[model samples]
Target: MDNKINFKDLWAKQTSIEPNPGDLLLQISKMKRSNLRKLIVTNLMLVTVSAFIILIWIYYQPQLVSTKVGILLIILSMTIFLFAYNRSYTLFKEDINSKSNTDYLKELLAIKSKQQFMHTTMLNVYFILLSAGIGLYMYEYTSRMTIFWGIVAYGITLIWILFNWFYLRPKQIKKQQLKLDDMITKFKKLNNQLEA
Candidate 1:
């Protein structure tokens, strides 16, 4: 007599859990709202920071042309990033329930494409501009310090930037991609079930 049961056989015999379309749509709606809120907050923060930087520029009135250029670059980077980020705001504006599965899927695909662009090209541009700006901005102050302190300051800043670019950026991109891919996959499954 066989004492061991066939676990694979049992697993195969069990009915697959089918996700209800309504539930999926509800969850997607909730996710969209959450994302929209985050977007708004992030945009506001960027705007606020940009305004602060502008105030500093006006108040301090940096002497070197390079310092002014650095400030401009930083502001420009933030502006460009904000513009690209705002493009996704349309996804949450309409009622998800009003759209058919096909339409929703198309919209999701468009979102994925836009996300890829933002995560890759836009992020790279932003980081590059930001790094250059910081490097230039630090130059004036660091020059005033002793040689050792100047080197230390630049080294620390470079390390921080590198950490963000190499570590934090990829981690964030992966997290965003996974979340979006999960929703898309769930929707696709629901779509296929409907067609079948």
Candidate 2:
């Protein structure tokens, strides 16, 4: 008896190895829904924190123009980011009705474009605005603290922001892009199979 592996058997198995198209579409839907849920939760948390900060600014009624401007900037940045984020969520939620794979692919591409924009240019603007706003806001508050403690507090905040901007953010962006790319690839494959 020949000990050689049956290449013909392997080739035949490969032809039947395709995942069910229905299962794939279901998986894509589940991924989209999970992403939507995460976005909503994140937005809610951010909005809550921003509202708390704004309330503090309003209640204390600080006389410092810099403080006022800083608070406003912080609020503005949060609002702008949330608006863009919600818009992205809406795009993701729009239509999963895979009437044709082409339509589904179009929506996925749109989301990928928006995700790229959010992670790149928007992320930079967001962090910059947030950092500057926090720094300016701290100007008035830190004035009440001892010099050393004030410096320490500011140092910690700066380091945290820098870490997020340089390290965490890129990792997050790459992970998100990879997830989207995987979904896109799966859909494209399904489309090819359907057409075939």
Candidate 3:
């Protein structure tokens, strides 16, 4: 006579642990904060750059139609982009955790869709317009410079823009999308568990 227990029985006796609802909300809040911080930094940089360019146009008084047009276009594009970015964020309340899970998920899904549209369509157009605007704005200024200096200026600008477009932009989009998708998955899992 031996006291023997099967592995299945031992497993059955183990207590089930569910994810803490509060913890989930906290994690979601952290993600939202991080995203907002990035957006703010980006927006500040844009505003600074736009202001600097406007000042240059005002002070230097470049005597070319193209320069004026370029400067105006670049400033316009920057303003538009910044406004759109800020407006989209305004749709998102500060504390997503304040809402019920169903409501939170709904809002999150809406955010995901808006972000996708902005990243996929609006941003690319903005980039193109900005690039063209800069090229135009610099045309008058660079025309007076030596070929080497002009190339250097445009080359540096192009490289920076390219890096943002090809590298940073994609990385950010992927990371954000992953975070949202992961959170959505967890929410679904929790909902299912409740239904069960």
Which candidate has the highest TM-score of all? 1
Candidate 3's residue-wise lDDT over 1-196, tens digit each?
Answer: 5568677898988897989999999999999899989898989999899889889978898999999889888988788788778867776656787888777766676676776677556676777788888888888878899999999999998998889789977887787678767876776776666567
Query: What is the C-alpha lDDT profile of model 1 across 33-109, one tens digit per residue?
Result: 99879988999999999899889889988889888888889988998888777866664565765788777776766
Against the true structure, what is each candidate's TM-score? 0.69, 0.66, 0.62
Pairing residues by index, what is the TM-score of model 1?
0.69
Please identify which of the two predictions, 2 or 3, would achieve the higher TM-score against the true structure: 2
lDDT (Cα, 0-100) at 174 in candidate 1: 85
The lDDT per prediction is 0.84, 0.81, 0.81
How do the residues 1-196 of candidate 2 rate in per-residue lDDT, one tens digit apiece?
A: 7769897897887655678999999999999899878988989988998999889987998889899888888887788788777876676566577557677766666677677777666767777888888889988888899999999989999999889888987887788778877876776786677667
lDDT of 3 at 104: 74
Prediction 3 global C-alpha lDDT: 0.81
List of clashing residue pairs for candidate 2:
none
Query: Residue 163, candidate 1: how far off, in angstroms?
Result: 0.9
